[model samples]
Target: MDHTTAETQLLDAADTLFYERGIQAVGMDAIRAASGVSLKRTYQLFPSKEHLVEAVLRRRDLAIRAELEAYTSARTTPTERILAVFDYLYEWFRQPDYRGCAFINSFVELGAGSENVAEIVRTHKRAFADHIAALVAAADLPPARVGQLLILANGAMVTAAIAGSPEPAREAREAAQRLLDEGVPD
Candidate 1:
């Protein structure tokens, strides 16, 4: 395979395995096997498992941010844009392979020891919160209100993942609406 093809295959395989199984639990050999890329090539591209993990996370982060921008941009109002995030979450939670936020899961599993992994997770979350903040900008909401909305969105992902239901997304949307209506506390 060419360099780009090999890299893409490795990432696709690694992303699936890392998300489905914990990062530590998945070996380079598994990624090689799944990707059908030679072990030597995998190492050549990633250098180490940690490097590969970081690459996978960075790729996911960009993709998610783009998707959220696309989803929210289509809406006409600030409130609709904010609520569209939960709608996105609801759809995500209902996917058959849904396993909560990949960054959250990665943070839980690898953030303690791996600074690279932790930083990637942090960057993903900060970018997401910023996206929400941009969506609610026209509403004149406080920055803390953006934080609250982020909490609701992340909480919905965790709650839905644990409960095996998408109800939390809707509940979170309602709670976010209440917060938007009531205004943030000083």
Candidate 2:
């Protein structure tokens, strides 16, 4: 396969394995086996396991941002768009392979030992919070709402993952709605 194809395959395989099995537990050989890419090629593309982990996280970050943007953009109003995030979460949590957010998982598994991995996870989360801030701003709400929404969303992810159900999405959405409503002066 070409370099681009090999790189893509490596990221996909690594993302799945790391998210499902934890980054510290998975080895480069496992990535090669899952990706169907040779050890030499894998090393050539990513000199270290940390590099591969960073790449996997970067790829996931881009994918998640694009997906969340797509989900919110489909709505007409700002509030709808804000709530759409939870809707997206609901569907995402329902996936059979769902294991909470990949960045969160990676952060827990690898962040302490790897600055690169930690930075990537932090960058992804900051970007997500910024996205929520933009959506909240469109509704004429204060920027502080961004932090509130982010906490709610992240809480839903963990709660749903632990409970093995998507119901947290609805509860989070309702809480988010209440927060949004309270922001209004009436």
User: Residue-wise lDDT of candidate 1 within 87-148, one digit each (tens)?
Assistant: 99999899988888899999999899999999999999999988888877777777778878
Where does model 1 exceed 4 Å of error? 183-186
Candidate 2, superposed: residue stretches over 4 Å from native = none
Score each candidate by Cα lDDT.
0.91, 0.92
Model 1 pairs whose backbones collide: none
The RMSD of every model to the true structure, in order and in angstroms, is 1.2, 1.2
Cand. 1 TM to true fold: 0.96
In lDDT terms, which candidate is top?
Answer: 2
